[model samples]
Target: MAASHPLLAVRGLQAGYGRAQVLFDIGFEVHPGQVVTLLGRNGMGRSTTIKCLFGMLPVLGGHVEVRGRPVNGHASHRIAREGLSLVPEGRQIFTDLSVEENLVATARRPRTDDGRAPWTLERVYALWPRLKERRHNLGWQLSGGEQQMLAIGRALMTNPTLLVLDEATEGLAPVIRDEIWRTLATLKQEGLAQIVIDKNVKRLLPLADRHYVLEKGRVVWQGDSAALHAQPAIVQQYLGV
Candidate 1:
């Protein structure tokens, strides 16, 4: 079901590294069960917006809310505890831990109110049987695709209220990327909220409920996929399509 209120909201969000500002007064939102895409070319502040959302960097200004509560300056761990899980740019699985260990390391009980079955180890393995076969393998032992699966499974194990992926399918084989996209579709069907950042506009447009295009640290365009589809010129101009 669509949320009456946004599950995640950012308003006039501003952030930077030292003296170099990356995000301006940018804003966007993700309601429950909605798949929203953060669209932009490299260095247009898409990642920076995500960093601010998860409290990886300090919020210079603006309101950052999760589940209708202000969380502007909270720590990353604090943000995670509030039910926001992020699959970062790199597949940052713990290199030393085994796949099974990694999945359980940050696991949290699923929320019962959502009317969805909580993700479990068995369920994750079912989603990707390769993971079940390699359960005892160290994180560093998995291929890039397997590692990406592990990263995602780890987040799912945490049972987040909102799952955010930065560069969701970057640098993976086409087959693996298809699997990832398929899994995302399944999650969306199950009513899990997500915000994905990927460069494939053709694929993303159909998967996402809404889209936000960023240009030079500002949100230049925002609309539903159909609206964006109607304006190919906009995609080509800002996204270099």
Candidate 2:
């Protein structure tokens, strides 16, 4: 089980590609078992935030804490070992690896006080039956949705305390998107904290307990789902296409 405090906390985070800053003092918190959505239109630094958290991009300022431990300066692999998992924007699975291989490649047994083990291959296959059917298929052989499922399953294999997903449902079919959302909901019930970045504001509203809106690399708005729904104009001003 996750600890009683926030699983992930990012404060005044500043990061970007060399000589090209993309995030400016961005901040958010994902409490234990809570689902938080990072909302914004394209080119709004949402992906940059994920990259910084995962150590893919260098941090120009601020701190990233996992379970109250500062991780902003850690190496990417070290961060992973510290219990942060990321399903990156492009579903970047190893194209040469098979479904089962992909899952096994990232599998790690987490030590929790509950004594319940982390995800097993059997459990992951059960959670995503389509993946079981495609167990032998290479990553390049699967469709977009299948690849997305594989990405998620691979992350779950890490048994992370915090899961960060960039573009969780971008360019997938409706059915596949629904599957991803349902899977996330189930993870929530299982007490997996997540930070989701996606464009489906309406759908994400219900899935996420709170919403953070980013604009030009800054968090311009933060509120609960109810507040967001009540102020569609805020969406229009900052997020409307």
Candidate 3:
């Protein structure tokens, strides 16, 4: 892929379940080494958009491009092979699998041309050492925080060029949330592009390179951290903060 090209580009995306339309011409782009956030109040189509991106839900219309390749109607696994990985909502780890099993379940090597250090079990463990300690524990045996860490490590094990995280720090202890944020910061330093969704706008402001605020399934506002930080009312109005 060209260095100047976006890692992922979503343009005029339209998707929903069966007969219930949710997203309305949604659009966003994530570039190499950038952290872009999807901010919205609950049920405003944030998670729905993520599902569409990962090919978990078919798009009703429009397109999603990964590494500049159109993947609108591709299967989820096929999308994963195209250098995108997701830490989906609810940290859906395999209940019967051990922590090591979960990490290696969907692991993959990077493309030769990817030109980045491929993520290995060791690297992921280094990022989240608690996972190393619980390597033999089953997914269900871990606490929520530990499960979330495993979810992230599993995604990293895929060696994705772009990682998408839904609700990056929801339903966690404050300390755990801080740990997650710090890991994200470390990933940022390592130049891993990410698409993140979370309620912690305060934590995201410094971590994110750009912000897209959604409402009624539409992008109501978008700007960089400085702009978003300057406009507190935007958060109050759109995010109900």
lDDT of each: 0.91, 0.88, 0.91
- Residues 94-170, candidate 3: write the lDDT tens digits: 98999999999999998545567789999988888999999999999999999999999999999988889999688
The 10 consecutive residues of candidate 3 with the worst lDDT sum are 109-118
Q: The CA-based lDDT of model 1 is what?
A: 0.91
Give a tens-digit lDDT track for model 1, residues 120-213.
Answer: 9998999999999999999999999999999999999989879999986899999999999999999999988899999998988878999999
Question: Which is the leading candidate under TM-score?
Answer: 1
Count the clashes in each prediction. 0, 0, 0
Error of 1 at 114 (Å): 1.2
**What local lDDT does model 1 show for residue 86?**
92
Better of 2 and 3 by TM-score: 3
Give the least accurate 10-residue stretch of model 2, judged by summed lDDT: 109-118
- Tell me which of candidates 1 and 2 scores higher on TM-score: 1
Candidate 3 colliding pairs, count? 0
lDDT assessment of candidate 2 = 0.88
